[model samples]
Target chain A: MTACVIMGSGNIGTDLMYKVLRSYTLDLRALVGIDPDSEGLHRAADMGVDTSASGVKWVIDNADSINLVFEATSAGIHRSHAPEYERLGITAIDLTPARIGPSVVPGVNLKDHLEAPNVNLITCGGQATTPIVAAICRAASVPYAEIISTVASNSAGPGTRANIDEFTETTSACLEEVGGAGIGKAIMILNPADPPIMMRNTVYCGLADGYDPERVVESIVQTVDNVRTYVPGYQLKRAPVFENGPFATPGGVVQTRVVVLLEVSGAADFLPAYAGNLDIMTAAAVRVGEALGAARTGGRT
Target chain B: MTAAFRLTDSTLRDGSHAIRHQFTVDQVRAVVRGLDRAGVEVIEVAHGDGLGGSSFNYGFSRIDEMDLIRAAVDEADNARIAVLLLPGIGTKDDLVHAANIGASVARIATHSTEADISHQHMALAKDLGMETVGFLMLSHMVASGDLLDQAKRMESYGADAVYVVDSAGAMTIRDTMERISMLKHGLDCGVGLHAHNNLSLAVANSLAAIGEGIDQVDGCLIGLGAGAGNCPTEILVAACDKAGYETGIDLTELLDVATDVVRPLSPNQGVIDRDGLMLGYAGVYGSFLLHAKRAAEVYGVACDDILLELGRRGIVGGQEDMIIDVALELRQAADSSDAPR
Candidate 1:
């Protein structure tokens, strides 16, 4: 089994460690964090995985057994650590918005980038919405797509808060680069409601004149189903809503516009079910990691 | 105790809601030029919901917000271009795009109790070297002490100023005084107020907030905004001038803009209609006025009932979808009662 090490013991890192521990194809190596007092490190120790406070440097020093590195640190930290992971020949699955590697949304285009040295799981918003964008693009000529992702306030960690700029830039870039939209805009909301709400996404895509809504809806449903494979909690909050437009588009007036609403409930592995933002990211990372690991093992027992 | 006050013209931003997000590019250019000539320090331009907010749910913008921002920036020679960004409605990328197009200031807003969410956006705006204001909408929903706590969070997040936004237009003189005074006392950054004229008190409340040492205040030309409308920039400037406060705004130019540029664009003059007054009385969010109206029509319920029920339930911004659900419930209850026993 390909052994994996999760670097950073924050919310995303801890959740990823839990996901990695349960993966049948990838073995959990260690949970590395800078804070020795972090509860994530203690939880890892309790789960019988090796724990360290030395962070990625320690992971590199002991790189013999680790084949994959999950870099869950901040975007700035990931920028420095990415090249080191590359030099050490350890495949890094980055959870930060650093975008050091090609962006991958597993449900949409994971197989295309499996052989790459490093893969970025974009932002939580990208992971949740891009697949749907990709689906629409596959069926029609999408001129512009905009997404708004709202997650519970409590679910946002310091890392998530600090990387807000990267989250929007990287997610919007990936919508064009990976999801194949002509132009993309991303918005993120942190809902501070008590009994914290689940992660919800609103995706709006502008279609060229005379495009078929039925065909577009079919493609979107297929993509939603594909995402549900890894993220069982993911579901369409409502069916795709289409509007005939005098709506302004980058390429003049659009014939039709499509709106799709999505919600993600967490599996409650580490964080609460409200933290579907973290769940979707970690879940996508696991799907990508296991697929890469399985390819390396050639499906051998 | 007199302090120099900065005036923000939000006719292009908040006023978009009053017009159903249909502000044309030509309109933005004209209004912006007028506001700049009138000596308004800041001119905010975007979809009423902010950048990246043109969608079916929020009501699509007739023109893309970026194009409007570019137009406003091109027209305004002296006024600093600003944009109101609800954290969830617009992102840092949108801010970057706005800044690139010469938007010099960003009001990063959130629900009053959710100021923590503005931290990242505020930090990003600061890093980009733009003047940042943390805006707490629906300030009436929280107590003065709680509002102070939220304002302090924004101040800590690198905001140059923090605003107590009466998004519902629900604050009275007492409400404004207690909250603004507490914020002025507790926060290290500058204090600002954004008032809605739902109760025809936008000017009165602005005066009260100014009395409590608010450094900046927002208004729209001709009082064009959500609910009854925002504080009318022209009227507020006149009032400030009469009260012996210095606003640095030209009353003559503001009057021309209000009469010529803004008034023609407004669908109706900004006045306290029943729905508008009910918003202030019910303490509902100003932005929710349109959404609640639509839901009221869809579910065959009175808009007033929806507003009152939403206020009772403590619905806040980002919960726009709840308007429909509440309207539906209200309709269903009414239906059951109307049926034969």
Candidate 2:
């Protein structure tokens, strides 16, 4: 069985590789890592994985059955190399926010990518919230929705700046797909978590023109339950409440309050979700990958 | 005395925390435009974490050194463009870039009492021909006398002015006045005050600082800043006007900036709303407002209770963003059915 090859070795790379290794039940044939940092490469070596300090192309030659590659390098590096990696037979899963590939979230569009060559993971925030978005879409069968994820500023990292635009776009796309609609807004907030906080996501859903607000709220709550099944960190922060008044809705049209709390694992000092939360998001990704693989196999054979 | 105050808007830089660096160029331009119209003298737009910007914590909204200076150039053509360059996050090259691109002032900020770090930025600013202001965060962390010593040290290092930043928004008017008086008496340079409204005393404390002879009034328009926000430029300007202080700004435009600009850009968040008042009463620092708000969203708790609860948790000083952690803890405690509600 061919497992996705994860490249780069930063926070995203390290976590994604570990999750892929743990969840898939099969050993990743070529978990190649290309990093100049000796410490990172040493860590990968210690993990009993292949380490490639040379160019990415050199690593490509080592594997014959590369099903997919996950690129978790910095934004600048990912932007320059991700597209080329996609062109190769290996389907690239970019966890970095460089926005070089089509944005993807597991369970929402895992089946769509099994045949495709490459895809990008939207963001830690989006990955945590999109299922709820999809669940909202599934429940309401609405025409539109919006998601506002306000995170602790400490949670906003290098990948955040590198992929701000994509975060908005991917979130919007997920909302549209979930609602089976078009043109939704997704706002990501990076708040300075003083005592620092575990990362969390908030979703705001708006229905098609003149739809019942009650129905939308009911559907979103139901979606949250489904999401909580796999993502335990998810909690319904605020039950869907109707906020209709001046300045309630930014655009003056969408009047809905659907807030969900995601209590992710945090460092001991509560300095937001550092490497520990990265591990949780990565683990979720692997779970989705396995589901995708099963669905692909089940559908094909 | 002109009876007006100058505003140094930092929404593009400090406010980037709320959005993480995902702010669009359009958003940056929009924020700058509002601040400019509000008669803000200096608009600080760039990476709050500094020029080197870490990948894990840097917000995309952080304009590169040159780009940030350039983007803010048009909006602040008349207003002096300032960039905050953290010592470790920036280099001499960043100072040089800021100076070349028309940055009139470089607020060289460092942790309060950290003289070496302040001196490094101050020296770099002087070399680049930029007005070198030394900002000491969490000014109340030490006694007024101790701060006076640091202020004198900063002046000796070539700092044009010494800025007392209430990073924790924890100071009272007495604290501000005492700090300003000390700086005025001990240092040859001018004194400045950057107040946080976490205690709802930002305006009062800033006025008191000015009364004690602080020359520069650092503010953000409509208080669109980190924590409860800095003293609202309009409110501060009006108070200064009534008090007959000279700030070299138009009071009318400052009011207009609040009404038309900051109020709209950050419509519901960080305003002096009821929640903001609660935060102040609770002695929660300014930076924690957004996090508390997020926690409120996450825990299904009323946003009103977050600050008070956080305050009770002994989270104070510059640790404003930790309110969310407290909120999450409260949630966990409530969920376990073990602790008292």
Candidate 3:
């Protein structure tokens, strides 16, 4: 198994640990955090995984054995650690909004960026929506794509709250570079509903005049299916709806487009099922870890 | 001597929400020309959701807000052009363009509890060498102390002034006095108050805020705004005149602008209909009125029920997507209740 270090022990890092524990091609080396008394590290230790309160320094010392590092920490932390990981010759699968590396949504550009030192997994909204935008772009030229991501308010902490602008900037940029849209807009909503809702995304692709609806739907479904293989909970809420629009955007006019609604339910590895935001990140991380690990071992995925 | 305050005419910004954000260049020029002639100090203009806010979720703008801002600037004699920006919805690029386009002020808005999100935009506006205001939307949702903490955060981020926005139109006169007093006491920057009339308290709340020594206040010509509309510019000027506040606005001219400019745009903007009243009663954001009505109709759900449910969920501004979600759930609940147990 390819040994790896999960560099954060928050909900995301802990969730990544549980997901790695189940991976056949990946080995969980340890979960690390800065706070010595962090509950996340204690719970990880209870599960018999090696844990660290030493944070990034521990990852640096242990870099000799680690094949990959999943940076589940804040974007600032990942940004500081990115070049460090690069110098140490370790591949980092960044789950933060830091755009230091090329954006990767596994189903869309995973193999393309494997040789690179670090790859950003954008935000959960980006991983969930970019592929579908890319799919529609394949069938029809998407001039403008906008994605609205709504998650449980309870799940969003002050960190997430503070990074709203970064989240939008990063996700929208990925929709263009990876999803192939000419213009991309990202919006996030923190829903205050009790018994929190699943992480949901609404994607609207403003199509050019001559695109075919049948081809667009076909392309989107195929892409969603490809995503489900890695994320068992990724789902389309309904068939794509087409509406004639006079959608006067800041970019330009969108005469016609399709709207796709999606919801992601978590696998409940380390958190509740409603936290599909965290689940999609961990699932994508494991998928990347296994892929990179196989690339290293020259074995089957 | 009476208390004096600066007047901000949102007949162009907030008024866009009442008319579905379809303000043409001509309308903007007409209103800005009139308000500017009447000695109004600031004319806030943009798509109702703010700069760069035209989208599928917030509904698109007819004339680009930039072109509209240009028209307002060209026609104005004295009033400075101000643009409202919801931090994530309108990025720093928008602020730069508005500044380049001769807009004089930037009002960066965020939910009261989410003031930290505006740090970058507020600082960026200042960095662009333009004046900026921190607009705290849905101020009634938080306590006075919490609201002041948010205002202080904005002040630290370089806000020249901070405004408590009653996006819900739900605050009482006392609620208005308490929040504004805390902000005025805690903040070193200028303080302003924006009120909606969903509870028929728009003018009263503004008067109360003025009593708390407010620095600025907003009004719409004919009260042309979302929900039951905002405080009427004509009425506020007249009331301030009676209350001995030197607003510096020409009352007859302001009324003429209200009658000839805004009233034509929203002739029925004065009446507080059922949806308008419910918005205040439920303490829902005023902008949610139109979206919720559309959602209620699409799902065959009662608008009042949806508004109350949204209030119960503690919905805030910028979370407009939840209106559809709540409507769909309400529809499902309605369908299940119709079935045999």
Q: Top lDDT: which candidate number?
A: 3
Tens-digit lDDT track of model 2 for A70-185 = 67676677777666665665556666666565666666676666665556666666676677667656555333445545554445555553345456666666566533544455
User: In candidate 1, what are the lDDT values of residues A52-147, reduced to their tens digit?
Assistant: 999877977888888888888888898999888888888989888878788898867888887888988998999999999999998999988888
Q: Model 3, A112-177: lDDT tens per residue?
A: 887778888888899999999999999998888998887776666567777677778888899999
Candidate whose TM-score is highest: 3
The runs of at least 3 residues in candidate 1 whose Cα sits more than 4 Å from the true structure, single-residue gaps closed, are B1-4, B24-41, B51-106, B113-132, B156-158, B238-253, B274-284, B291-341
DockQ of each: 0.27, 0.02, 0.47
lDDT of 1: 0.85
Residues B83-200, model 2: lDDT tens digits: 7765533555667777787787888765565544456567768887888888876676678998887777788889888888887677888888888888888888888888878778
Report the lDDT tens digits of candidate 3 across residue range B23-134.
9988888899889889998999998989877887788788888999999989998899999998767877788899998998999898887787788888888888878899
DockQ for the candidate 1 complex? 0.27
Q: Interface Cα RMSD per model, in Å?
A: 3.5, 11.7, 2.7
TM-score of chain B of each: 0.96, 0.79, 0.97
Tens digit of per-residue lDDT, candidate 1, span B1-341 = 43378888899999999888988888889888888887787999998887767765577788788999999888988998999888766777788899998998999988887787688788889999999998998899889999999889899989999999999899998999999999999988999999999988899999988888889999998889888899998999899889988888889988987898788776476768899999999988888888888777766899999999887766667566556557757877898999999
Q: By how many angstroms RMSD does model 2 differ from the true structure?
A: 10.0
For candidate 2, the per-residue lDDT at B79 reads 71
What are the TM-scores, per candidate, against the unseen true structure? Answer: 0.87, 0.60, 0.91
